[model samples]
Target: MSLPLTRLLRKLLHVAAKPMRHAQGKDGYVIHAYRGYGSHSEAFLMGRIFRQPGSRSQLAPGAGRDLMDVGRRMLRWGKSGVEVEVALGDNRTTAITDRDGYFSVHLPLDEPLEHQGQWHTARITACPPKQPPVEGEAQVYLPPISTRLGVISDIDDTVMYTGVANKLKMLYRLFIESAERRTAFPGVAALYQALHEGDDGQQQRPLLYVSRGPWSIYEMLEVFFQHNRIPVGPILFLREWGLTLQRPLPRRSEDHKQALIEKMLGLYDEMQFLLIGDSGQHDPEVYAEVVRRYPGRICAIYIRQIGDSDSRKAELDRLGEELAALGCVMLLSTDSLDMAHHAHANGYIDAASVEMVRAEIEHQLADEPA
Candidate 1:
């Protein structure tokens, strides 16, 4: 569809969704507190207030049910202008939801929090006009002072087989498939778990994910992570598919990812990051640019080889050479095990964890159809 027609349709949909919002408000509003992350003296949390129908129970997956669930998640209406209160460790702050019903809390600590290197709870409440206050808890990850490394990964082809290079197949899998039907890359779960556990197998390094996908698929991605036994991070920075007259299209993926990575670097200035992404898109170029901009902040870059282009390979090799000169190791490999071994060699993960990752890869390969 043309940009103008798409914008018109979205406007109509927004108008139709407004009535459903007030009607559902009879049942009260819900605060969807997404997982957040924090440092010793600062915490950042984000969530949305919505007048949902009621809580949804986990139901058996089927074609019709999956379609309906996707529709429901995508068509949710945000309750705008709602005041949200967030409390963490005796610190309280309030933020009003924007037109999209999203609110963020950036709480600076009066006294530095003692780092236990685990998830902390932040209470969130939203009292919509004349309605009972809805309550939820946001899980905020606080990396321990012992943390030596941080991990940032891409979700599409890096962690899962999303066929992003083929846009039609990518959209089909994204919109039509259930979480159960979605396939994660073999051994990715093990590799990520090891990375999260760190080299000593006791450290609590932070693992943050960045995706170019829309926020509408957040729940589905969570479900996919749980089903695949992947360690759930405190945050998955996703893009908003907003359509306005000033900008009919969403922000460029390269710009969106670069900005988020920069934000992550700034958020945890004490930690260096290991970047993981796939060669199916612009990950190598984007990561290389980040490495250049923030020299020595990135420890390493691992690019999963999903494409078979010799030119692309040469390009990545050149980028790898450039990164090496800046004190970063860039690896372009077709197997997750190779990345795992490299990480182990560089002291990013344990030696035993490399074996575990290898075993998982072998098992997944055996399970593949002949």
Candidate 2:
């Protein structure tokens, strides 16, 4: 038979072979497991319900049970939006399935700070088919550093605004497009070069960036930084997992980003930080939690107030107060370069380094033509 015919024949045989076998003896199932990073490194195991020839005998007579013969369980990992599900069974049950035989349900990991900002683990279990189902677990680590004086700002709107994230329509902005159109908000590039370049005799501490943009865009961002003569460190990004009809997405939240910061902190303990973020989502909240948990790991928090919105400013203020209580500076700006200049002039950045960065930013901008 042709390949198409063969596939159709196989599917037909698969269905025909099952007959009307209800969940009797067979008690096995399948699971699609995924782990989120950083504080969300929790695992949620989802399973389905089914019975085989021998299960009927195992079923106790007059046994009270779910009519659809299905049950689901969850585990806590301090992460959010972990969903799981069972294979296709019945419409009566809440379990939805696809032709490939799968299901999903969302479970969240409790916050780690609640437990002294320490680490925690979670496990989930379920039963299903010829083989017995097994339980799975995931771990969550403490948040990244909490205090800092030196700023680690991305060249993009944490400092410069290429206009990817709409100052007018923030909600409509997504990662890919945001990355493409990103230009430096006036003076922002200069500011980065200034602080990163430093004027004093010493080297400035590193400025780390963890972007949701695809790794493929690395060249563009890198060129922009180097062309502008901005000093920076490793630019962390995700490699394209591949295009799917379901819609492309970044790696799990807290997963890729939080992990990157956490690793950087481990590399330098005494170093405090000045975190910079655009008016985009999560950066403020994520930075807030990081500060709350790490305490002295961060020295300052700077959020660029891109578009006109009081809500984000209010949130940064609240977080700033908390940081202030811990003795950290909280700087919010509509422009990145201004903050960059502040970091440089304050003696937070060395004079020699400032000169280098300033030279670069000047050259890049000056060449842009009036």
- Which model scores highest in TM-score? 1
lDDT of 2: 0.45
TM-score of each: 0.84, 0.47
Which residues of candidate 1, in runs, are more than 4 Å off? Answer: 1-26, 54-76, 111-117, 163-182
Predicted structure 1: clash tally: 0
Per-residue lDDT of 1-370 in model 1, one digit per residue for the tens? 9765554444334433333333333345777778888887788999889765532535444443344443554555789999999888777889999888999899886754444647888899897888778887888888887676899999889987873345455544444443334468878989999999888888778999988877765665675688678999878888877787877998888899999899989988988999999888888899999998998899999999986589888888888898898888899888989999999998989999999999988887787656
Question: What RMSD, rounded to one decimal, does every model reach?
Answer: 6.8, 17.2
- The positional error of residue 262 in candidate 1, measured at the CA in angstroms, is 0.8
lDDT of each: 0.79, 0.45
Question: How many steric overlaps are in each model, in order?
Answer: 0, 56
Q: Using alpha carbons, what is the TM-score of model 1? A: 0.84
| Candidate 2 Cα misplacement greater than 4 A, ranges | 1-151, 163-182, 199-201, 239-249, 252-255, 344-346, 350-370
